[model samples]
Every structure is written in structure tokens, then in C-alpha cells.
Target: MKFGDIIVAMSIIAIVIIIIIPVPKSALDILLSFNISLALLILLISMYIEDSLQISIFPSLLLITTLFRLSLNISTTRYILSEADAGKVIEAFGEFVIRGNAVVGFIIFLIIVIIQFIVITKGAERVAEVAARFTLDAMPGKQMAIDADLNSGLISEEEARQRRKEIQREADFYGAMDGASKFVKGDAIASIVITIINIAAGFTIGIIINNMSFLEALNKYVLLTVGDGLVSQIPALLISTATGIVVTRAASDTNMGNDVLKQLFAYHRVMFIIGSVLLVLGLLTPLPNIPYIILSSSFFLIGYQIHSRLKISTEEEKEIAEEAEVEEVKSPENVMSLLKVEDIELEFGYGIIPLADANQGGDLLDRIVMIRRQIALELGIIVPMVRLRDNIQLNPNEYVVKIKGIEISKGEVLFDHYLAMNPGTAEGDIEGVETTEPAFGLPAKWITEEEREKAEVLGYTVVDPPSVISTHLTEIIKRHAHELLNRQDVKKLIDNVKEEHPALVDEVVPNVLSIGEIQKVLANLLKENISIRDMVTILETLADNAPITRDPDILTEHVRQSMSRYITKKYTQGNKINVITLDGELEQLIMESINQTETGTHLTLDPNTIQRILNSLSMNVEKFTSIGEQPIVLTAPIVRIYFKRITEHAIKDLIVLSYNELEPSVEIQSLGMVTLK
Candidate 1:
């Protein structure tokens, strides 16, 4: 064991020993002096600490000190009752402090007991219990705040974890303190009982055993008993005061003395008013004038000094601020900061500021936090922090979403109106301002709150302004999510997988495929709107087939087949999938056109052939859209990748799935065929 650990163990052991074993007067005196010194040190430390956690060990310390004090009481009682002399410390207190009056000394000791037990210890105990209860109650809200910060990218995962740990520690500290305060209360009670017993028992023993008169017995024994009570209670009082200070201490950046002085004297006006009042009371009333006049002058002088100091300080601060502003403009770092590009930015106009400000009842930031979490669950990748900026350059209702400093999509919202779309089932049209739904480019109209219920009654889908913007932002992020996946993000994902499947990661990363290669595979999956949350299966598939082909495209295709169950469940409606299929000849022609090179595979189809294929695919896809079904293309495994490369730019929401990428149990109905004429 370390030296400190051994010392603490021995100290606790020695406290227990002191209760049983008799000691010399000199040794007892030293222990008494040490106890007093230790209590004073604890009190000073409590005053200096800015936070309760700074003295987290204090709860345990309180128990030990209480026990030590009780043990000393036992030793001193033995010396008083049997030998009639506890030590020089006890005797001196009896002789000098009591001044030969036992009754008065006992009364003073009773007052100290009442103050420590009823005032300080009782109040500290109540404060500790309430603190613990409040801390426990606020835990859920604090945890959610940390999660929101993590989701919004205001803090890193490590910072969130540290904050959560700190909150738990705080709760535990308060809970322990709640129990430890009882030790102080019990110590106070024990002191009174022990002092009474020492006096009564010592007086009887002196009269009967030593053959002394009643007055003589009372003089020696009662004096010693009162002295012992005073010595023990004095230290106990200090400890009890320290406990109150600790439980009541608020979070601060300075010690208690500084805080008290700064806050108490913060207002010079109050000081001056008090000084004037004291002057009037001294002059008009029959009160003594010298002390009152002297105090009044002191207060007035302090107020004047404080006012002058504040004025000078304010002027100096103004000058320093001016210098800092000039220095900031001259600094090269200022220019460099402007060059930094946000990965995802949502820049809106001033009219929409209320949507981002929480104080104004805006849930846009909260919605953004949910959007990030939604994206993570859907894509299995953490979306970068979305920076919300107010731009005066745009129109009051206009907002734009940017990816890597380039505008990807823009939308406009009516601050006080709702966008209502017909969904093809509405019975009639409503009179409103005509506008296009920004998310999907559908024709819609902006209506007021009065018209929202009427529009809904007419079978129209109505959405508020914030939802409109949030939906548009979500779509834009989903579309460009692949652009946000870099090697570093891929590494983070790989590390998370490694924690659970170390051998799988070790086999696949660098040994089978590089991080760049894995990033490409993940990006490809994200581009196709496939969820990579089943990372174990994806890695397992890669580990199986990576040796045969190092191409990310081919590896991605394998991972897709392995995730067939998920894809099947995601796209299937009523246990059936509606899809367009490629004609066998077209599939063959596309597969044959694929060119293999040192870099990777690519389709080398002539422009004419590519045009015919896209035209045929679009025509077949329209059939699914006519029935309000999502358009998906089913093709042979080899032709699926190359065919998607051809039609992705032409079809906005095209979903191409190979036969191998579907579950065997699901039924597929072919809506149309993409045959090149």
C-alpha cells in the first residue's frame, strides 16, 4: 500500500484504540491539540473551496472526525471519573476558562450545544437532503441537454461523456453529504450526554471513593467535566460550521471571503445611505456619538473610494476594448477564420430568426437536433454540425441549405401562413397565394391559420413554416450525405465496430481494404439511401469477399446482397414490391459494355445506346408514379450498378435493386419493362 493509504488506515485504527486504551496526560493533551487543529483546518478549507465537489472527500472526513471526537470524549471521561485529572488542556480550561464557577461554565457549554445541534448542524442536514433530492430530480433534464448538445455538434462525444460523468458525481456527492450530516447531529447529542455523565459520575466517585464533601467533590469534578465539554464542543462547533458552509456553498470562481466582500460592498450607494443614517441616529438620538460618528465617516469614505475606483475602471475598460477591436482588425487570423467552410449550413433571412431562437418559442434548433439523430439512425453515419446563420442578403422569407460552401437547395416560408398541398384527393381549391412546395417542387398554396382546418377538411396536407423548412433541410442532407462521409468519419465508424468485433475489423481494415476503400463503400451505400446500421453484417460480408475483389463498387454490391432482408423490409409495401424490370437483351448489352481497367469497372456504352436506355427507363418509371407508388428498377446483379450510373441523373427518386438484393420470401410485381427499341 502507498504511504498515504497506510497512514489513513492506521489513523482510523488509532481512533478506535483511543476509546479502549488508557494514555498518559501528555499524550492525551497532544491528541486534544491535534483534534482542535484538524477541525480548524477543515473549516478553513471549506471556506476556500469554490465548489462542493472540490471537497468531495468531506463527507467521509466528517464521519471520521465525528468518531475521533467521540473517542476523545471517552478517554477524557475515563480520566475525569477515575483519576480526577484528564490532562493539562482540560485542567487549564477548568481553572482559567471557568474562573472557578462550574454552573456558569456548564450554562455556556449548553448554549454552544444548542447552537451547534439546533442551528448549524440541523440547517446543514436539511440543506444536504434538499440538494440531493433536487440533484436527482434534475438528472433527466441535464442528461437530455447533454444529448441535445451532442446531437447538435455543440460538444464532442467525449465532452458529452465527461459532462454526464460530472453530473453523476455531483449527485453522488450530495447524497453522501445528506447521510454524513447526520454524523454531526449525532456528535452534538453525544457531546451533551457524555459531559452530563462525566460530571454526575465524577462527582459521586469523588465523594464516595475519595471521601470528600459535596461542595469539594462538585468543585473538582464539575469543573473538569465543564472544561472537557468546552474543549470538545469548541472543535465540534467549528466542524459543524464547516458542514453548513459546504452544503450551502454556491458555484463561484473565488473563495468565500472574497465573494462576501465583493458582493456585500458591490453597491457604493447602499454604503453611503447607511453611513448617512448612522450619522443621523448618532446626532439626533441619545445614542453614543463618538463610535457612531467614526463609523459614519468610514462608510462615507469607503463609498467615495468605491465610486471613484469604478469610474476609473470603466474608462480603462473602454480604452482596452478599443485597442482590442483595432488589434483584431489588424490580425491575420481574422482573415483566416472567414475562409473556413461549414460542411452543412442553413442560412435564413432575418424574418425566420424567431424559428431558430429558443426564447422566441422556436423549435427549429430542437428539430435540427432530431434531424441529426434521424439521419444517424437511417444512414448509420453521424451528420456534421449544421450551422444556422442569418443572412441579410436573401429575401425576408428565403432560406438556403448549403453543403461544403455551395448552395444545394433553397426554400421560402410565409412566417404566418401554412403550405397546403392537394395530394390528388382534395375536393376543392382554396383562395390563397400560389407557391411551389420547396421540398418536392409540388404546386401548393399558402393559407393562414384560419384556413388550415378548412384545408384539412378538404383533404389537403397542411404544414407549418418550420416543418416545411426542416423537411427541405432533411431531404437535402439525405441527398448529399455521401458527400459528408470522409476517411475520418469512416475511421470513427470502423473504431466503433472494432470495439464489438475486433477480429472482423482487423481482418477487413488495411489488411483486406484501406480506410479510403471502406469510405467509398459506405458512401456508395449512403448514396443509394441504404442504412448501414447493420455494420457487423456489412463487415462480415466484406471480410468474406474482399480477397477476391478489392473494388469498392463490387464490395458494396456484396454488402447490399447481405443486407437484403433490411432492404426488402424497407421498400416492400403490404408484402409486395412494385418494380420496373430490364429486358434480358438490354441487361446483356449493358453488362457486355462494362470495361474493366486497373482503376475499376466502368460502362463504355455509346451515347446513343445510353440515351435509349435512359428514355426507356423513364417511360417505365412513370407507370409506377401514375399509381402513387415509388419507382424501383430490378436488374441482374452485374447490370444493376452500371444501369444506376446511367439513370440516376435522369430520375430524381429512382431506386434500382438487383434480384440478389431482395429477400426470397417477398413477391415482386413488374409494372413495366425498360426495353431499348
Candidate 2:
């Protein structure tokens, strides 16, 4: 064991022994002096700590100190009764306080005990109890705030963990202090009882055993008894005051002494007013003029000096700020900071501010939070924080959604109005301003509050202005989710999956394919609105086929085939799907035009043939839409990915599937076929 640890252990054992063993008067005096010194040190330490957690061990320390004081009282009582003296320290304390009068000295000792027990100890105990309760009550809120910051990327996982640990430590410290405060109270009561016993027993012993007269015994033992009480009570009072200071302390950047000096004298005007009041009282009232005049003059001098120093410092600060501003403009880091772009941003005009402001009863901010959570559940990728700010450059009712600093889509909403769109089944017409829905480009109208109910009754879908903007933003994010999936996001997904399937992640991540390759495959899936939440299957598929070809496109096709049941359930209704099929000639044509290179595969078909293929596919896709079914094209497994890529620009919402990427239980009905007609 370390030397300090050994000494602490030995000292505690010796303190317990001191209560039983007889000690020489000289050694008792030294031990008594040490007790007073230790109390003083504890008081100083309590005053300097910035936070209660800094002295988390104080509860245990308080118990030990109280025990030590009681032990000393026992030892002193033994000596005063048997030897007619406790030690020089106790004797000196008695002589200093008694001053030839025992009653007055004894009364002063009682006053100190009352103050320590009734005022300081009682107040500290109550504050500790309240503090402990408040700390425990606020723990849930503090933990939630940490989690919010972690999810929003404002703090790292390590930082969140540290904050949670500090919160727990604070709760533990206050709880222990609540119980430790009772020790101080108990020690005070014990001290009073012990002092009374010392006087009564010593008085009896002195007269009978030492052959002293009544008056002589009364004077001798009373003096020694009072001295012993003073010696013990003084240290007790100091420690009680320390206990109060510790429980009441709050977290701060500086120690208690500095905080007091700064906060108490924060306003120079208060000092000036005090000085004026004192000056008037000294001149007009019958109070002692000299003392008041001296104090008033000192206050006025200090206030004037403080005002002058503040003025000088303010000017110096302004000059330093100007210089720093110029230097900041010249710094490279400032320029670099300006280049940092958010992953997603929602900018709206002043009229739409209420939709994002919680104070205005707008739940757009809340809706955006739900949007992020929904995307995570559906796509299995964490969406970054969506920055919302008002833009003065746009119209009052206009809003724009941006991805990676570029505007992707913009929409307009009328405040205090609802947008109503017909779903091809509305039987009646509604009077409102005509508009096109930004999310789906369907014809809609801005209707008044009274017209909202009427429109809904006529089979029209109605939504509030905030919902209109929220839906538009949600669609824009979903469309561009592929662009947002980077290597870092892929790594986070891999780490999450690693918690469950460590060996699968280890085999597929860096060994079979790198993070960039995995990111590309996930992006491919997201581009088609496929959910990557089933990460284990995705990793397993990659582990099987990644060695054959490092192409992300090929790997993604393998993953899709493996997730046939999920895709079938997503698109099929009533165990049936209506889709367009590629003709045998068209499939063979695509297979022939496929060109391979070192980087990856590509289609080298001539422009004329591509346009003819697009025209034929467009005609076949229109047949499904005419029958109220979604446009799905069924092609061979080898040509499905290439066909989707070829028509992505011409047909944005096309769903091209392979025959193998379907459940056998579902029936596929081909409504038409794309042919080279």
C-alpha cells in the first residue's frame, strides 16, 4: 500500500483507541491542537471548491470528524475528572475565556453550541434534503438532453457518456450529504451532554477525593470543565459551518471566494448609493460621526476607483475587439469555416416563420423531428440535423428545401388556409384558388376554413398549410436520400450491425469490400426507395458475391434478389401485381450492347436505338397507369438494373424489377410488353 493510504488507515485506528487508552497531558494537548487545525483546513477546503461533486467524499469525512471530536471529548472528560485537568490546551482555553468569571464563560459556551446545533446544522440538513430530491428529479431530463445532443450530432458518444457520468456523481454526492448532515446535529447534542457531565462529576470528585472545600472545588472544576467544553465546541462550530457551505455550493468556473467577490460587487451603482446613504446618516443622525464618516469616505473612494477602472477596461476591450475582428478576417480558418455546408436545410420566408416557431403554436419543427425518425426507421440511415432558417430573398409564403447547399425543391403555402386536392372520386366542385401540389404535382386549390369541411365531404383530401409544407419537405428528403448516404453514414450502419453480427461485418466490411463500396451499394438501394434496415442480409449477400465482382451495381442486384420477400410485400397487393414485361428481342438487344471496362460495366448502345427503346417502354408503362396500377416493369434478372438506369432520367418514378426478385406466392400479370415495333 502507498504511504498516504497506510497513514490514513492507521490514524483512524488510533483515533478509536484514543477513546479508551489513557494519554499523557502533553500528548493530549498536541492531539487537541491537531483537531482544531484539521477543522480549520476542512473549512478552507469547503470554501474553495467550485462544485459539491469536487468533494464527493465529504459525507464520509463528516462522519469521521464527528467521531474524532466525540472521542476527544471522552478523553478530556476522563482526565478532568480524575487528574483535575485535561491538558494545557483545554486549560489555556478555560483561562482565556473565563477571565476570573466562570458563569459568563459558561454562558458564552452555551450560546456557541445553540448557534451550531439550532441554526447552522439544522439549515444545512434541510438544504441537503431538498438538494438531493431536486437532483434525482432532474436526472431524467438531463439524460434526455444528452441523448438529444448525441442524436443531433452536436456531441460525440464519448462526450454524452461523460455528461451522464457527471450527473450520476452529482446525485450520489447530494444524497450522501443528506444523510451526513445528521451526524453534525448528533455531535452537537452529544457535546452539550458531555460538558454537563464533566462539570457535575468533576465538582463531586474534587471535593471528596482531593480534600478541597466546596468553594475551591466549585471554582477549580468549573474552570476546567468550561475550558474543555470550549476546546471541543469551537472545532464543532467550525465544521458545522463547513458542512453548510458544502451542501449549498453550485457548479461554477471559479472557486467560491472569487464568485462571491465578483457577484457581490457586480454593480458599482449600488456601492455609490450605499456611500450616499451612509454620508447622509453620519451628518444628520446622532450616530457616531467619526466611524460612519470613515466608512462612507472609504465606500466613495472604492466606488470612484471602480468606475474609473471599468471605463478604462471598456475602452481597452473595444480596441482589442476591433483588432481581433480584423485579424479574424485575415485568418484562413474563418474562410474555411464559411465553406462548411450542412447536409440538409429548410429555408422559408417571414410569413412561414410561424410554422417553424414553437411559440406561435406551429408544429412544423416537431414534424421535422418526426420526419428524421421516420426516415431512420424506413431507410436504416441516420439523417443529419435539418437546419431551419428564414430567408428574406424569397416571397413571404414561399419555402425551399436544400440538400448539400443546393436547392432541390421549392413550394408555396397560404397562411391560414388549407390545400384541398381531388383524388379522382370527388363528386362536387369547390370554390377556391387553383394550384398544383408541390409534392406530387397534382392539381389542388387553397380553400378557406369553412370550405375545408365542405371539400372533405366531397371526397377531396384536405391538409393544413403546415402539413402541406411538411409533406413537401418529406418527399424532397426521400428523393435525395441516396445523395446523402456517404461513407461515414455507411460506417455508422456497419457499426450498428456489428453489435449483433460481428463476424459477418468483419468478413464483409474491409476484407470483401471497403466502406466506399458498401456505401455505393446502399445508395443504389436508396435510389430505388428500398429499405436497408435489413443490414444482416445485405452484408451476407455482399460476402457471397463481392469476390466475383467489386462493382456496386452487381452487388446491389444480388442483395435485392436476396430480399425478394420484402420487395414482394412492398409492391404487391392481394397477392397480385400488374406489370409491363420486356420482350425477348429487347432483352437480347440490351444484353448484346453491354460494354465492360476496368472501372465498371456500361451500356454503349447508339443514341437512335436508346430513343426507340425509351419510346416503346413509355408506351407499355402508360398501359398500367391507365388501369389505375403503378408502372412496374418486369425484366430478366441480368437486364433489370441496366434497364432501370437507362430510363431513370426519362421516367423518374419507374419501378423495374427482376423475375427472381419476387416471392413465388405472388402472381405477376403482364399487361403489356416493350418491343422494337
Candidate 3:
């Protein structure tokens, strides 16, 4: 039976004493409590003995308690039942067991108190340990997910690596904090308070049912129970319940959706409702037998309905949130807009930035914005973007600045100007060459045999489509001028080659000589009838042999140039490059290389290997009779012009190149000397 039922039953027993034995309320209250206590004690003892002795004592215990109660006359039992004292006993007993849950509540309180006392007295170090344990339990696969993202192109390889690291790091950090913080500021506090209150309430409730049976002191605000040294103070119970519920509601809200808090909040809700109704109904109800059973069933149904209602309300809230999110996506501007401002620190010029403009008043975020922009203008940055919070951010590895000062966030392209010019300039920037494509408006043209011949005859650096002296010299300068123009490096390099191939040196020098020697050498030494076109080209070939670029950059000699040359020859299929469909002279050259390949060619004609694949529509040819003209680029959809670099010593390496690269690659492949590192 519930505490309320027990209280009501006890009241009926009180009236039984009043009629059959004729005693005062206080004496009757003691007699009834003693009877119930003895009954409970006997029930527990019986269960224990029967389990050990192999005999059932349940019936005997029940009969003994029943016979004692049977001694009361029916008229007296009905009188006490009318007084609501029976309700109080039944209600109190049920409350003490169910709502009060004295056993569980006691243990929970002890644990919380002990933990809190330890935490307060010493420290809370194990909190992080506890949190880490939970985080470990929640960890997903360490690297495979990120690798899949990278391999499938969901992210770049670098980004996938970053993402994997980020997830694992975040989970670990969050787990540690979660486990530790939950108990410190969450359920542990509530458990200790609830336990003390409920235990005291139960005692007061037991005594109150005893007093309320007297009928005289039945006032709402008065003490309802009077035992040996205890009394159920109705006013105190009400005050405690009200305070506890409000605090509980707030605490529960705090813990909601929080992994740690959710567990704690549940325990609080379960205990609170039972404890409250038990104490109040026990000594108050005036109903007899029918009311007790009906109220018990009603409480059970209501509790069920309350649980359902909370769940439905939570679901509705989630639906409303989802709807709001859908509305936000329809507006592109809203989608692109940055989240609200957090914190801003402005910088200006090369020194400590001055706070020139002060915001006197405005929203906190607005003031921050005004001050930051004002400072940025002082520094001469044209368009200063507000830095947004970088949460769960992954670094773009493809475009990292040099290693000297690797600030991943600020860099876009891997080329840092400082590093390209003078590497190791500062921390975070690494040393690397930043090669800019000359393909913007026009690529500098190489002087062909006709243009260079014309330029040498005309005595000036000039070129047409077939090429010229000046343009060719500039091309040579670009490749070899990293060392000073007068460095003798190119000359010495050319001299060494000339010892074996004099004609090659003669073809290159007159068009491009060191600082002040170009005109004199050309005029004095018949730099002869050598076509300046072939001359510049030969010099370029020499410069190409120079060790300017080295790995992790490139080195034509780092690998056995002979072996590299061998592969180039071995990979070339037919001494003619083929353009799958285009069988022109250019196409023939490409086919020659493909046919010549003897080593295992890893390049497959798979769908994955093809990008922007199509066929050529028509042939395009541009004729330039003079210099200073644009070379036209013809596009034909049906024409298949793809890159082919037989380097990387691995045919599979072509996977990283772009569509434009294939054309140059095919050209390089024809040389039978190209090597990529």
C-alpha cells in the first residue's frame, strides 16, 4: 500500500481504538504506529526466516497483524477512517518507500557528500580522468573516416588528415570536461540536498499521521504528527517542497541535453513527485475506502501522462527549430553572412597599432567593428575582412606558405613572396620557389630559326610568331638569371658544353651575352651566320641543365639523367606523338612516344583518369609574319588534348596533373630526356 493508503488505514485503526478501547488521540496514535512498525518488522523477519529455513512465514505475519487489527469494532474503524487518519498512514508509508525512497536516497546523498567533501577539501583532478574515460568510450575510428574523405575527394588528402586530427582532438577535450563538470556543478548538489530533506520529511510525515488521527489539532498549518520526539510540521513540509521544486526545475533545465546532467536530472524528478504528494495527502484527505484506491490509480495515470507530455513538447521544439533552419537556407545572403561578431583586435602599420578611433557608444559588437576597420585603414589594407571564428576548421595543405612561418589560416597559395625572393625570411614561412605562369595575357615567345635570323640581321631583340632575338634572350634570362647576369655560370656551363658541341654554343651566345659583352661579342666574333633562333634555343637547353631547382623541388641530375633519359626513350611508343584522333604532324609526335613505351605504363584509360574529355571540332593554325602579335588558341570539343608526362618514374603519377598540362607533357615526352621528381 502507498503511504497515503497506509495513513488512511491507520486513521481507521485509530477510530477503532476510540470506540472499542476508548482512548485519547495521542495514545491511540502511538498504539497504531507501534502496530504498523511491528507488522513491517515481522514481515521482514518472516521473509528472511522462510528463505533460510525453507518454510513460508508470510501468511503467519499477515495473520498476526490482521488479528491485532480485527480486535477493533467496525463502528470505531469507520470513525477514524472518516477522520482521514487512515489516509495519512497509508500515504506516509507509500511515500517513505516510493517517493522518499529512503534507501536509494541515503546512498546517493552519501556518495555526493563524500565526493563533494573530497573535492572541496583537496581538489578535483580525477574530473579530467573521468571525462577522458567517457571521451574514449565515444571515440569513432581514428583515421579511416578522414582517409575515405580524402580518397573519395570529399576533401583533399591534406584536409582529410587535418579533419581526422581535429575530430579526435575535440572529442578528447570535450569528453574530459564533460565527465568532470557534470558532477561538480550538476546532479551531485541536488542529490545531497534531496536526500536530507526527504529523510527528515518521512519522519515528520510518520508522526503527523499519528497526530491528525486526534481530530482536534487537524488545522492545515498546525503540526499533524506527534510521536515520541518527532512531529510532522505541515508548514515546514510545504515550504521545503516549494523551494525544492523551483530549484529542481532550474537545475533540470541546466542539465537537459547535457550528457552528464541528464542522468542526474532524471533521478531528481522521480524522487520529488513521490515525496511531495505523500506528505500532503497522508494527513489531509477525508475520503474513506473508495477515495484511497481511486486516488492511487489517478496518480499513476497522471504520472504517465506527464511523461508523455514532456516528450511531445521536446519533439515539437525540435520541429520548430528545423523549420527555422529551412527558412534561413532560402536566402543566399543570409546563408553567406558571417555569424555574429565575437572578439576583435586590430593591427596597424609595422609597430604597435594605435587606437585612434574610439567608439563612445553602440552595441558591443558594433563598437568592435568600427574600431577594427578604422585601424585596418591606417595599415593600408584595401579590403580587410573580419576574422570569423574558426571552429572545426581544417587547414588547406595544398596552399601552405613556406615552413619558416607556416600560418595556415592567412595563406592561400603555397607561394609566399618573401620565401620565393629570400627564403627563411621569418618563422612560419618556408623556403620554396614560387613560379608564376607567364600565361596571363601572352606567354613570352621563344625565338624560332626565322625570327632569330631576322633579329641578328636587324641587330635588335625582336621576334614574330616563329620567334625573335629579344624575346628569346629574355626567355634565356628568365631561366638562368637567378644567379647574376655576369655570374659566368651560364657562360662556363655553355663553355663546357661547347668543348663537346661548338656549334651549339655558337648558336646561343650572340643573341644573349653577359652584361656589357653582348654587342661586342656579336659584332667582333662573326657569331657567324648562326640562326639566333637556334642560338637562344641552344642556350635555353644549356640553362635547363643547370641545377637551379632541387627537390623537394626538382633536379634534372638528382636522378641518373641517363636512366631518366632511358625511361623517356623506353616510354615513347613510336618516335611520333599521337593525338588519339588528330593525326597531324603534332599528333604523330605524341603517338610516337605512346607506342615506344616499353616499361609498364600504369596509365589506364579508366573514367577516373579522364577529365573534360571530348573530341576535336576543327584544326586551328595562326600565322605571324611580324613580332608583337597574339598567338590564337583554338578550342574544339571533339579534340582530345590531354597531358602525358612519362616521369614520376610511375605512370600512375599522371593522376595529379590538369588538362592543360597534358599538352606540355606530350611535348616534353618527345625529347626522350624529361624527368620529374
Highest lDDT among the candidates is held by which one? 1
Instruction: State each model's CA lDDT, in order.
Output: 0.90, 0.89, 0.33
Q: Could you tell which candidate, 1 or 3, scores higher by TM-score?
A: 1
Tens digit of per-residue lDDT, candidate 2, span 1-677: 55998899899998999999987889889988988999999999999988877778899999999989988898998888888978789889988988988788888878888998899989999999999999999999788666656544578768988999999999998999999999999998998899889878877888778998887887788788888888888888899899999988877888889999788776788888888999899999999998888888888887888788889999999999999999998999998988989888889999999887666877776677678889988888888778788999999999999999999889999999999999999989999999999999999999999999999999999999988987898888889889998888899999999998999999997988999999999999999999999999999999999999999998999999999999999999999988899889999999988889999889878888889989998887777777788999999998999999889999997999999999998898988898888
- Please write out the lDDT profile of model 1 over residues 1-677, one tens digit for every residue: 65999899999999999999987889999999999999999999999998889999999999999999999999999989888989999888877766877677777768878998899989999999999999999999898778767655579878999999999999999999999999999999999889779878887898889998998988898788878887898899999999999989987999999999889888889889999999998999999999899999999998998899889999999999999999999999999989998899999999999988766888888898889889899889888888888999999989999999999989999998999999989998797899999988999999999999999999999999999999999999899889998888889999999998999999988898899988899899999999888889998999999999989999999999999989998899878988899999998898888899999999898999888988888787777778888888999998888888998888866899999999888899998999988
The TM-score of candidate 2 is 0.84
Off by over 4 Å in 2: 1-38, 51-102, 129-236, 246-252, 266-269, 359-363, 421-432, 447-462, 499-501, 573-578
Among the numbered candidates, top TM-score falls to 1
> What 10-residue stretch in candidate 1 is worst by lDDT?
144-153
For model 3, what is the error of residue 621's alpha carbon versus the real structure, in angstroms, after optimal superposition? 34
Query: What value does the lDDT take at residue 445 in candidate 3?
Result: 26
**How would you order the candidates by TM-score, starting with the best?**
1, 2, 3
Please report how far candidate 3 places residue 468 from its true position, in Å: 56
